[model samples]
Target: MKKTYVLDTNVLLQDPQAIFTFDEHEVVIPAIVLEEVDSKKRNMDELGRNARETSRIIDRFREAGELYKGVPLPNGGKFRIELNHRSFSKLEEIFLERTNDNRILAVALNLHLEAKKENKEVVLVSKDILMRVKADALGLKAEDFLNERAVQEDSIYDGFQEWEVGEEQLNEFYREGRLQIPEDKKKMVYPNEFIVMKNSINPSQSALGIVRSNQQVIEKCWYQEENAWGISPRNAQQIMAFELLFRQDIQLITMVGKAGTGKTLLALATGLMQVEDLGLYKKMLVARPIVPLGNDIGYLPGEKEEKLKPWMQPIYDNLEFLFDVKKSEDLDKILSGIGSIQVEALTYIRGRSIPEQLIFIDEAQNLTKHEVKTILTRVGEGSKVILLGDPQQIDHPYLDEFNNGLIHVVEKFKDYSLSGHVKLLKGERSSLAQLSADLL
Candidate 1:
């Protein structure tokens, strides 16, 4: 049966093109939602850009016909501006306040009452968890906007799989430097994905390999036999991470792990080796989004680099360890002396062509899908981008574990040979830190 979808303001703000996603269904935009979107249109951020785009989409649709009534959408759905269902009589007794959320709920509630008379379904769509709960309490159908999610929470690809094989086959693989997987197993693997071949009889005996684009063969992993800028892989996952981080053919890589899994450190180490040691790239640029506790960087005092010192401190710590700068001012002298190494905020990354650079975007889990797309589009020819983040630690209000930019790119680019990802398990920071990451 066909149903009506009532989208909340947050949904449009997250994705401006959401109107065309629903196929052959009725899409209603409440007047209150328009009011909320208009209020956010002046702010200069992703939300503001989305708000402006949403208004422009609505206005462009208005040229077709009267939007207050109904207009034909290209996706075979009808779009309308809900004007009559703003009454608050039913919600005032329980919700008590006439806030924006309550007003949006009132519109949905009134629509539900009308739809019940016709024996049709009216669903309220939102990204806010509390809004869905409140809608359920009011006996109205509610759902989360899931078009942005590439995979379910449990079904997310972690880029590592274990295959059980006989000891002879494992030995043959080690001898020949390649192994042909079973047909059933080959169907489940992706290009550039890491595979751990474990002995069927002896679980302790295992060999690590990576799946090539063919998906039927597992090739030997490119482990860091030599130290990468004084840092070596401590575990199997880090070993897999090193291959993806250092490979020149793979232009895009993503590493997901806990807080202390050395994701950032490994990325910095590999970047330094390639940019400074081998001179494969002309420069090394590290950038991260400014989203965390407390105020933004504008509230702080000093020059651009001085203002970024607090956010870029972790990058400096990794550099300090890699460079073996014993003196307090040693790292500073190296940074000032080296022209190839650069660090900056992700806010200024827009509208520039970054060429011949090794780019690392740390704490990338804080970025949204559009933000990630913007940053990636800025990469010019002969540039590599590495996104490192812990999905468990997210600070963005609109993003979560499954929908953030880091996991989004990981899932979308898994099939292509140009991108590779690995989710680090064992934390190599310290015993206490590992325990806290697991327990907390």
Candidate 2:
């Protein structure tokens, strides 16, 4: 049945095109939401950009028809600005504060009351957890906006699938370096998705390889060497990641894992291998989103590079381990001397064309879908981009494990031959680190 979905401000900020996603349902944007969007339209960050985008989108819809009354959406739904329900008829006693959230709640409550007379349903959609809770307390149906979420509980894509096969088929895969997938099993796998063919009888027997060309064939893993730049794959998942990273054909690779899972280290090693060792690219461009954990220390007083030093320390630590640099000055000297390999700050990475480079984006879970799109769109010809992050460690208030950019890329590009993803398990940083990742 068709229902009314009143959008919260954060929902539109998280995804500017959110209005069109409520297929065949009423999409109501509270007048307060417009005010909130207007206030953010002039800032210099992604939120500002989204605010402007939302404004333009709503304005374009206005050109078709009056938004105050209701405009017909292409998805066979109604879109409108709820200017009439701004009164505090429902929330006067409960949520006395006239804050934006309460105002939105009041609007949704008024709409819900009105809809009941017509036997309709009104749902308030928000990205904010507390807002949803309060809306529920106010006796309004609430939902989290799910249009941009890439991962679902219990069904997160791990980039690999296990297929039970006959012993003969498994042996054939190992012998011929490839196995032809039967028509019945082909639909289970996507292109470039890794498949583990285990003997149906022998649970101990398995051959790991990647699906290719519409899951018609499974090719053997690509990496022949044991180590890249003195770093070896600690387990099978890392090996799979190495295969994807080393493959020149796979231009985009996403590595998602926990804290000590070595996602960043592996990307850096492969990037160095391709850029410095093999000269496959002109430069190795390493970067990460500058998301601070816990309480922020405010701004630092220094030049751009100095200011970025703390935020990029984790990247440096991995690089130091890879290079065996004992002194910070020595590391700096080495980085400066090797002009071909550079650690870039994501803050300055915008609007720049990066060509013929091996790109590694760490802490990518903090990025929004739009931010990820912007970064990936900047990748020029002859470049390979690796996005590495743990979705569980997202620091952005508006992002979660389900909706962050890394997982978004992993889910969106899995079917494409140009992209490959591996969710690395078994952290190899140390026993203590692994324990902390698992327990703490």
lDDT (CA) per prediction: 0.89, 0.86
Please list all clashing residue pairs in model 2, or write none if there are none. none
Tens-place lDDT digits, model 1, residues 361-427? 9999988888899889999999999999988788887778888888889999999989999999999
Q: How would you encode candidate 2's per-residue C-alpha lDDT over 1-440 as one tens digit per residue?
A: 89999999999987889999999999999899999999989867777888999999999997888899999999999999999755586678887788999889988999998899999999999999999999899788999988777855636789998888999988888889999888888877878888877889998998889988667999999784558899988787988888999998999998889999889888888788888888999998887787622222236877767877888899889889999989888989989999987766676677999999888888999988878888999999998899988888978878989888888888888888899988888989899999999998
**TM per prediction:** 0.95, 0.91
The candidate that wins on lDDT is: 1
Instruction: Point out where model 2 deviates above 4 Å.
Output: 61-67, 84-89, 151-154, 292-299
- Where does model 1 exceed 4 Å of error? 292-297, 326-328
RMSD of each: 2.2, 2.9
lDDT of 2: 0.86
